[model samples]
Target: MIGFARTVRLWFDPREIRQEGVTPDYRFSLANERTFLAWLRTALALIGGGFAVDQFLPGLRWGWRVGLALALLAAGVVCSLRAVNHWVRCERAMRRGEDLPVSRFPALLSLAVAVVAVAMVVVVLVGWEG
Candidate 1:
């Protein structure tokens, strides 16, 4: 099962193979793979954020600490799932020679970042002692 999924993922991974001719499908698949990796990085950052906040602000109340953890975990999960979904859709589109779908990830990620920033500001201003 994992191998099958990896095969499908590879079919869409632009960096996986380089053909002689640079077709539209190939270009889009490559873009898709780049996007997937970007999302994976975003997810990792979110997970790191959870740990950072917990460790750096040990004085935070349990409620705020838990909230931060939950927010970070949720962001990671969302980003990871979106990456997989985008890869699958891009693969399908390439296979069918159809136009790739428009991505709303930039907007979503921006909003998430803003939210995180606000949370961080609040934590520092209201909670942190030094």
Candidate 2:
């Protein structure tokens, strides 16, 4: 889709973002960058958790192991993409003097993580050896 392609392009094209409106306050931009970095850190943690689940849980049944690992990996991928997209949107909004864009991603991501935690608890209690 055109929208998806444009989003991908934005990730690599800083000039496109800079072209939008005037430069925002340095402090606001720095804050946005910090938030972006935090999202990236969270993504890296999720990715690492996925790898750990796959590599360290050899005793886990193949189905559960693959499913849980894949879920975490997918979440990490989404979070990374979202981090860039959100950064770009927020930057543009600030430059244009518009209210910062809002997203439901944080709530959705939280709910997803909670679901994963519950699943993990079930898996642990059920015992991999069984």
Candidate 3:
């Protein structure tokens, strides 16, 4: 409970997090920032892919089309949110000289993308008549 409160506070108040631990080497912080940016780029790609799926696949069945687009969009939203929270967590850990936090997000995200891909293949091969 207390941990959640602190995370919430850190979410809104980044300055407090920065003040909590001694400043680490600038290179590590920059690396973390780069990673955050990479996640943002991935999130953007997911979001764009969602829009593309919706706009480009006019022939796909309505239900399947919407489902795919919504899935991608939801993944994008989750990824973007996770990116920020992860950035905060990592930054704090780095400042405190603790090991970087580990997460299963990458594996989960990969699984999601694989599922979406398989769905796309099935829709394409079996044919979705709209």
Candidate 4:
């Protein structure tokens, strides 16, 4: 368990974590933590939604259901990875007194979810037996 914890910490940021040049404002750090948690929650929800669609949406075509599940699962993976990278970048910027980095992940996530929504609409209008 101790080793696992260490691994998780390193996963969050290997090089810059406590290569912390200095501690910045605690409020900024707290805000960063909250943002990370929010992204994590969103990722979890996407994963759960994918599972629910796979399990509960019996009227959907098999191909349509699988496609939706795959898309949501893929998006969740992308969100999780982006969350870690974002946390690392934000923490590094804070420690160095530099501008925080921006990520295109938010736009990527939006686009992905929008595409999934449109696909779902088409699926509903098409071969859905119910």
Task: Candidate 4: list runs displaced more than 4 Å.
Answer: 1-16
Query: For every candidate structure, what is the RMSD over all alpha carbons to the true structure, in angstroms?
Result: 5.8, 1.5, 1.3, 5.1
The candidate with the higher lDDT, 2 or 4, is: 2
- After TM-score superposition, what is the CA distance of residue 109 in candidate 3 from its true location, in Å? 0.1
lDDT over C-alpha atoms for residue 124 of model 3: 67
Instruction: Specify the poorest-scoring 10-residue window by lDDT in model 3.
Output: 121-130
Task: Please write out the lDDT profile of model 1 over residues 1-130, one tens digit for every residue.
Answer: 9956865676567665333223454676788789889889989999898888778878887788878877888888888887887776676667666787788887988898788879878987898653
Quick one: best TM-score, which candidate?
A: 3
| lDDT (C-alpha, whole model) for all candidates | 0.77, 0.91, 0.91, 0.83
Clashing pairs in 1: none
Query: What TM-score would every model get versus the actual structure?
Result: 0.72, 0.91, 0.93, 0.84
lDDT of 2 by residue, 25-50 (tens): 79999999999999999999999989
Q: What TM-score number comes out for model 2?
A: 0.91
For model 2, where is the 10-residue window of minimal lDDT?
A: 121-130
What are the per-residue Cα lDDT tens digits for candidate 3 across 1-130? Answer: 9986777678899689878779988999899999999999999999998999999888898888889999999999999989988999999998888899999999999999999999988996676664
Question: Which parts of model 1 are misplaced by more than 4 Å?
Answer: 1-28
Model 4 lDDT tens row, 1-130? 9954654675656574778678888998999999999999999999998998799888997888998999899889888877876787788778988989877778878888998888887887886784
Residue pairs with backbone overlap in model 2: none
